[model samples]
Target: MKPELQLSLQFADARHRGALARHRVARFVRAALETSGRIAVRIVDEDEGRTLNREYRGKDYATNVLTFDYEHEPEVVADLVLCAPVVEREAAEQGVTLEAHYAHLLVHGTLHAQGWDHEDDGEAEAMEARETELLAALGFADPYARG
Candidate 1:
C-alpha cells in the first residue's frame, strides 16, 4: 500500500482554518490511484492560481484547481495547485462541505495526474464513477449529485 501512493502537501494560503483535514485530502487522492510517485498539492490564492493557470493552461482566469502532470523520464512528480478561496466559494455554491469539496478536487486532480482524461462523455462518466466510489469509501458524498 505504501509503495503505491505518495503525496506531499504545501499549505501557502493566508487562512488556515484547521477546519479541514489535509490528511483526509491526501488519503482521498491516494486511495484512488495506482501511483508509485509523488503528487504535490499546494494551497494558493487567486494570484498564484491565476498566474499558474494562465501560464500553463492558457486560461486567463484562475480556476478552482490545476493539475500539472510531471513530464519527466524517470519520476512522476505532478503538482496540483488548489485555490483556497475558489474552493470555499464552490463548496458553498455547490452545497457541499468544504472537506468533501476538497476531497473531490484532490481526487480529481490525482486522477488527472494518473492519465485519467475526461474530455468526452464516456470518459467523464467512467472517471466520475471511479471518483464516486472512491469518495464513498472515504465517507464523502457523490460530488456530482444535486443538493
Candidate 2:
C-alpha cells in the first residue's frame, strides 16, 4: 500500500508568493518519500532562515534548504525550510528554473527526512544517485549536474 501523506506549505516571504504551487511541491515530496507522514515546507526570508540555521545547525549563514526530521520508521514526520532568497539566487546562478530548483530541494529534503544522508563520500554518492533518479522520474534534470 502507498503511504499516506499530509503536507503543509507556508510561504513566509511574500516576494515569492506565487513562485511555487502547493500541488507541485506535494508531488515532489510524495515522489521522494519512502513512507508517509506529515511534512511541512516553509519558504522564508534570509533573516529567518539564518536564525534557524544558527540556532539549530550552528551555521551563521542562510542556506538553500534545511530539513528537520522528527520521526522516521512506522511514519515519517519532518519540516523542510527553504530560504527564498538563497534558493532564487542559486537557481539563477545554476541557470535552472525556479520551480526546478524547488523541486530538487524538496526531493533532497524529503530524502533527508527519510534518513538519507551525505556525510561521507560513499553515502553522498548513493544519495546523489537516488536523487538524480527521482528527479529524472519526475521529469526534471539531475540536480547535481553542472553546465
Best by TM-score: 2
Q: Per-residue alpha-carbon lDDT of model 1 for 50-119, expressed as tens digits?
A: 9998899898877998989874335456888899989999989998988888889988888888788799
lDDT for each candidate structure? 0.80, 0.93
Q: How accurate is candidate 2 locally (lDDT)?
A: 0.93
Which 10-residue window in model 1 sums to the lowest lDDT?
14-23
List residue ranges in candidate 1 displaced over 4 A. 71-75
Residue 91, model 1: Cα distance from true site in angstroms: 0.1
Displacement of the residue 63 alpha carbon in candidate 1, Å: 0.7
TM-score quality measure for candidate 1:
0.89
Best by lDDT: 2
